[model samples]
Target: MVVVAQQTPSGPSPLSVDELVSALELRTSWTLMRVALRSEKLPIGLGWKDLKANASETHSIAMKLRSFLRDYFEESVVTGERYVQIYEIDKALVATIVNACKAVVIPASPFSSKYPLPLNVNLLATAPSDPTLCDVRNHQNGDISFIFCSAGYYDDKNSYEYGQLPTHVQQTYVGIDKLVTVRKNYYQSYDVITLRTALDRLEISVDQPGRLGSLRFEARPMEILSACALHFQSLQGFGACPPENLFPAIAEMYGDHAAGKVVALAFRTMTGSVKRERMTTNDDDLRDERFHHAGMIAVGQDIKPYEIELDMEFTAPGGIAGVKLAGMMSQLASANPTLHGCYIKAHQFIAMEKALNRLMTFI
Candidate 1:
């Protein structure tokens, strides 16, 4: 039988995140053309034709890059074992790297602008060709995703004001562009390089206090965060983990085999308004607290809030429902009351947990 690797007290021979970063940076061209092509946002457009073309190009590049990166990461993770022969990236070290990766993300979408078109135009076009006929289609169809109608546009301030695409279309375009970036970065090789570099810098920052706050993973609002987690896991070599136990579990998995590693956990500690008179405010004081804490986590903060409510789920590596990942939510909740106080519907918990699990797998 093959023997597994172990860590020594000296810190697994010291993997240099800085060195890895230097290696990647030296070879990388973060210039406009490269970044745009890698981000798949190249060849900007103003009209529907150009926008459609951009979207098509994004899809094409995304598919190709995603396939290649999947294989690359698989090799990286499997070969991670070999790295240990010379130097092992400790679990805490890996955690720090991932946390750094969570920082410095910008939207890759080109479409978030407003679209200006009348909803009824499609109806008018479809109606019997009468010069006096005016399309009566619902202009807000695109605005509301479910409000689908025949081909059309929405007349909204966003698009009209910008002298560009309507609000809905702009939003959709930007949203799609961002999605394409997420798809490529999380699922493709170039994106993997960025992630690895981020992780490397993260570990270096951890070691060097002067750089502490430099590589921060911005917090995605709850809904987006959940979605992003799932998206990250879709990359080829990524695996899933239980939502609640994801961080700690992955921390352990990437930890040293011989000796336990020290993960540099950092996040801003919060202070909430506790006065009795302020409780009457309509703002969700408790929800706000939870939201803030989640943000801290996104940036790799190790914070304990006064109150919290955790909604989590678990699954097998392949996205199958298995044992529910438990314990951490309650444990963290005990540490932060805000976590314990939040209310998540049962179904929402199940769905979010699955989503979180899927995300962890991809990361």
Candidate 2:
């Protein structure tokens, strides 16, 4: 059950479970949702337009959903050595694993022959333990398959967009989906949560197992953005959609495993606000400090002087990334034009995929 505020023509009002199911259009015909897509059967659930007026943010969500539904996003791809491998895969085992996954998220039921043959797997798994959070199926070809992890999380909180906002360090991180930018005298602190999924546009992998019948599916970012957008809209006091808590990126992201070490080590200064000191420069400052290009550092390396990119690595003795000691980063762009800001990007020691055999399915 969801607890959300809705804005009706008469103002805010309560919404019933049935009303929510209809208004939110929970009933889809196929693919990601559980409902069937037979031509003869009428679609379930009334769309928001049919009910009360939806939140203004809902339109934004709709637009993002439309754009994000692509087969791939370069950011979501776990390039280089950003992946872990699995072993002992067999042709016979594939069916069992596939069937088990379907059962885990979908209930067994009798169906007609006209039932969609080989329906794509898309559904939430909230079993209270290691649940399936975000997934957008791309495609499947024999043993080779792929997917896009719509949900995104950084091991370091400061690397996230909302986390980069100029707010007190004591700001509450809870109810992140409810975060909205308040255009007041000073920027209001917001919870570090979503629609930020698209910001990461995190691309994962579809690895090929050795001499083994191993490989996998397809997915996208649109679904993830749409989900977060709904969650954001719900908090708008217009209509509550999927709450942010449903996303593992905000609800259960951890420094150890869920978020790879690459994401943890990343510190984002270039994209968001770059001011280090909150000391205001102007008297009529709506923002805490002046935003400079100090966060964006694109320079050349030692030998590759011509190679241009956000290549300059900000390094220090202990570590170049992290919120507490981030200021200690002395490595700035030298001989670089954009000297004001520092460069930060997810780094991997190796430049290629490294394989390690494990018994796990999810990474």
Candidate 3:
């Protein structure tokens, strides 16, 4: 597991975001990543704040929320890079939470901004993943997850602006540099040995406040909150669940093991490779002869979105499907067109009948 520093631009930093982007060779584009839910149809009474996943991919509640959302969140009509995590909540419930009585959020996104008021529960919790893999005990009594996207979701590396998404963190990472800072007293380097030592010396108590929050996992405050929103959106998908039972389900996912590893990976180098090593120095040396600055850290290749997977298909080697599953695969072909092959989602494949449904020819 890679360990990077939780570097946030406060007053001023040594290395600049542009410099980091250039050094890391980051793919500079406005791509809106995804976080999926395990259900059918969108949640109810939810309103649209921006554009839907697909213009053709519908969401009925959006149309209904138009007028009401005007007061809460103003839709984005500008131009530039932005992103959207596919989820929202019941408008009535949201109204109640914001207007009537702010129900006690035992905890929002564990990494929410400290400066902000109303305690914006930033990071959305992810759930309904491979049930076999769930750590029920850890996440059972209330857990939070941030894995917001599934491999099948599409990402356009060129669309700086998401039709309806407001202008937000133009990129998943403010810059590749922010993530690669895994060294101590060194906020902008990727020295493997330094990282190993740093993690060893680091002490994080989930029971303690402010440690993880200071180690932010996402770019902007709202983006993280958007993540927290995705969790509620997923709850809406669990059909027919009585409110009595829902609270327990919510608690179970809170204590998940994701808090530790997921965060490290989010800031990991795109290729899992480090550039420069952190300058090693003794405690006395630091107090005596100051150490090197972040500007000196060496940069490596681009750091793509974490857990980004493409859903595609190919032919068997002997001319079955018509694709050679070989070589390095970075991205996908244009929308609707399989990169020289056909593709089907696992769910779609399972839903297909073993035999074809013969249609009658009515001439």
Candidate 4:
């Protein structure tokens, strides 16, 4: 039974129980129940036309209906279970209620002869606490596999002229057809000292003997001048030679100059071996001469005589071989020729002087 009330100008007035019961009639359908509230003037026996005429009565009825719906839906039917219903209503007081049932309804079975076969599921467990192991696990799960291949063939005549293949049958050329079937574990470990020590050991194993020696040559002044001329010719493309006036040998070329003026010269070549040795001390300070010398000695061991050839020609005043030869001849004139007696023979002096004079005119 629904009870509705209306407010008057002076006080409150409500619908009697009989009027409320008569006004609302519940009609049931298969899925829901509905109640229609209409105006009292309508032939529908319930005289709600007067209620609608009064704005206050209409509002009162709306409020009462809302409260009644809430209570009816919330009530418990069984000892522990409550029946719930959802309802919708118009602003004019017409309402419909649907029974909300709780049941798990499953659809038709998806397994049939036409459906594709199910794939087997495999589960793998890896150590979650270790980051490396977890990475491996992720790699295993995310790994993808695929196959790709390509083949072709072509033929052409007059291949050389057109830059085409004459009779080339290129078949099954698998450039990168491979499958990564297994995973390999890689562990890398290296220490600066360890690597340096290993390299040092390798150097020591291949270390050869060190050589240290010098070579000296002595010849007549003329022969020396001739050699100088030839050497100068070889280096002509390098740079210009010094003028004749720079050489003292030019003075002896004329008859007016004195004879018996000889020259003595020597060339010394030295070769040293070098080897690498690991440092014994923890101190890496380069400022220490001892430490520096140790490294230098290792480097010195690698020097070979042939590899360290010193060309006096390029080291001369004019950076020309002729200029250097002239300077050597001048030094011979100022210094005592007898000092290098082992290299200077007595018979070679006069011949050397004459040769020196002739060579001077040639320059």
Strongest candidate by TM-score: 2
Native-to-model Cα distance after best TM-score fit, residue 252 in candidate 2, in Å: 39
**Candidate 1, 82-195: lDDT as tens digits:** 000001133564454344434423332111110111122323334321111111111111110000011211222221333355677667666343221111111101001112
lDDT of each: 0.24, 0.23, 0.20, 0.20
Residue pairs clashing in model 4 are: 40-48, 40-49, 222-355, 222-356, 273-300, 273-301, 273-302, 274-301, 274-302
Q: After superposition, how far is residue 334 of candidate 4 from its true place, in Å?
A: 42
Name the runs in model 2 displaced over 4 angstroms. 1-69, 73-81, 101-138, 143-363
Question: Which of candidates 2 and 4 reaches a greater TM-score?
Answer: 2
Name the regions of candidate 1 deviating beyond 4 angstroms. Answer: 1-41, 53-244, 247-302, 305-331, 335-363
Model 2 residue 114 distance off true place after TM-score fit, in angstroms: 29
TM-scores of all predicted structures:
0.17, 0.19, 0.16, 0.10
Q: Is candidate 3 or candidate 4 better by lDDT?
A: 4
Error of 1 at 101 (Å): 34
Give per-residue CA lDDT, model 4, range 293-316, as digits (tens).
Answer: 465465652321100001111111
What 10-residue stretch in candidate 3 is worst by lDDT?
354-363
Best by lDDT: 1
Instruction: Name the TM-score of candidate 2.
Output: 0.19
Arrange candidates, best TM-score first.
2, 1, 3, 4
Compared with the true structure, model 3 gives a TM-score of 0.16
lDDT of 2 by residue, 1-363 (tens): 322343322345544333443322321112211111111132322443422232222456433322221111111222211222112223443444344334322122221110111111221121111111222222222221122222121122123456565466327664353344422111100011111121111122221111112121112122322333342332233112222111112111122232222111222243332223322321222111123222222311111111111111132211111111121222334332211111122211111111110001112
